[model samples]
Target: MDFRPLAHFTAQDTWLNDPNGLIVRDGRWHLFFQNNPHGPDWGNMSWGHATSPDLLTWTRHPVAIAHEGPEAIFSGSAVEQDGRVAAVYTSAYADGRQAQSLAWSEDGFTFVKDPANPVLDRGSTGFRDPKVFRYGDSWRMVSVEADERTLLVHASTDLRSWTEVGRFRDEPGTGIWECPDLFPLRLDGEELWVLVLSVQDADGSRVVHRVGSFDGSVFTGGPPRLLDAGQDFYAPATWTGAPAGRRVLLGWMAQPTYAGATPTSPWRGAMTAPRDLSLARVDGSPVVVQKFSPEVTAAFSREVADLPPAALVRCGFDGDASWEFRAGPDVLRLAVEDGSLVVDRRASGLVDFHPQFARVDRLPLPAGTTGFSVLLDRCSVEVLAGPLAVTQLVFPREPFDELRTGGSASARVFAR
Candidate 1:
């Protein structure tokens, strides 16, 4: 099957993983990612750059930060400072030591490593993935202590010097925490802090998040919850300087079980389509609501009659809704049943890559959600329903382009 997606961003002839330094500057979106320059498999990690005026069409740039000595450039965040773009990332050393590093770009395409590299180091073996943001006149960063399962916070006046301020302890989980991100979401005239982190173990990886309050130093939260119910969403990053003062996010759409086993040669991984994030009241409690960005929706102005293998479709319904896709013997079903969003891929085709790829994943929808969007590609499906979104990777032995719907709903399909 042809696995190329029409709307999602994928690196050309290389491997792409966790999103890094996602920021909007000068009306363009700069997306830096954890890339393996060597081959389709994961190795020789560096920061690969791409710029898009609209999220639909991406222009790939050269490797911004090449692999240095024994250290590989890991995931981090980006900010616009003093009319220039600065990237703070984790440098993973070959000896198992990790430290925070800095790089700056004037054009947002080419980056230069700082002379005083390794800006912050805790001398801990598990410290990495620095997420930097502005707080008052100083800059704040959050890095994960993977071995200890804690988030270490630091403050810096200058990007070169940093002081440890506070730490966030993680709740019980499978493995180490990676790619820690802390941001504020406004809900009911109150701003709440949302912490996102990825958990990895021998089995696979998943993203978990917490909604709470964060003072200048410490983050106080009760417990964490799963960010996405689907199995393939991981290592998500939110952009700082987005248009119209919006918080946008993109997640890596692959899992550890069969990430390297996909049939897409010369390119290993792709990103989930960009989603606009906001806080909403779900059953009287605040939850993160993810919807397709306006930029993505605008790209699908031309409507088509049927759902192509690669298409963008939006569905609206009130009480109950069900959508089905079939190709030969393979079938995939999506439904809102009993106030829950269910994605049944048991018969979606070609599940031999992993044992858990052929199961049904369900997530509770908001109390009054009546509409949603579905972005379907050849090998994956992303569903944005009310306050929740799911990204799942699938493989069909044959391509499926037939779509059917039930209940009081209308489907508008678009192709690029």
Candidate 2:
């Protein structure tokens, strides 16, 4: 079976993980990620580079930041400050020590390491993944103490010197937390901060977010709720420098449970399409809602009856509904029941290669949710409805070709 994704962001031939150094500079979107330059499995952790005029089509460039001697570059964020692009990342040493470091570029493509590197060091192996942004009269940073499941918040006046101001710890951790993002959004003229984190354990990995208030030094928030219920969404980060009022996010679309066992060679991971995030009221409480960015929606705007290898299948219903996409003997099923959107891929062909590959994923939808959209690629499926998202990676022996609806369900298939 062919596994090349046409509409998703993937490395041409390498392993990729958390997206790093995401920013828009000089009218182009620059995407950097945790990449293994040598092979298809994760190692030689350097930053891979790519640029996009729009978020849908990407052009690959040379490795942006490579490992130096005993230090490997890890995940981080980028900003265009004071007429240059600056990146603040984690420099992980060979002896299991990690510290925050700095790199800068005059031209967004080539980078120069700061001679005075590792501007911030905690002397802890678990400290890494710094995400920096502009704040009042200076800059602010949020990095993770991974094993401790705590977020370390720091402030800097010139991107080099940092002072620890506040910290937020997730209680009784089930796993280590990594790749956090803190940003603000306005809803109905009220401003609220959103914190997104990726948590991983032996069971699997999932993304969660909290809505709260950040007062430059401390973030006081409410309970943590899932950002995505799907088994494959993790390590999401929003790009800086978007048009005013737009917060665009992208995530690595693979889970830790079966990432090593995926059948794809030369490339082992892909990114979810860019999601446009906003806030809306649900049950009288404010929650984050995700919709396909305009670029992605325009790519899959053609309507069809037979499912293509890459397409978007949209379904609408009044009450209970069910839909199926069948190709030969394999069938992938979807249904709405018990206030949940269910995606069943247990019978979607190639499942035996990894025991965890075949499963049912469910996302709870809002009460008035009458429709949901599924983005299909050669090897994955992402379901979105209102503020609910369920992303799963699937491997079928053959591509699905037909869409069938039942129980008051109606469907419209769109292909690029």
Native-vs-model 2 lDDT? 0.89
lDDT of 1 by residue, 91-147 (tens): 889988888999998988888999899988878788888899998899999988997
Candidate 2's TM-score reads 0.98
Best by lDDT: 2
What local distance difference test score does each model get? Answer: 0.85, 0.89
Clashing pairs in 1: none
Q: Quote the positional error of residue 361 for candidate 2 in Å.
A: 2.6
lDDT of 2 by residue, 118-177 (tens): 999999999999999888888999999999999999998889889999999867866799
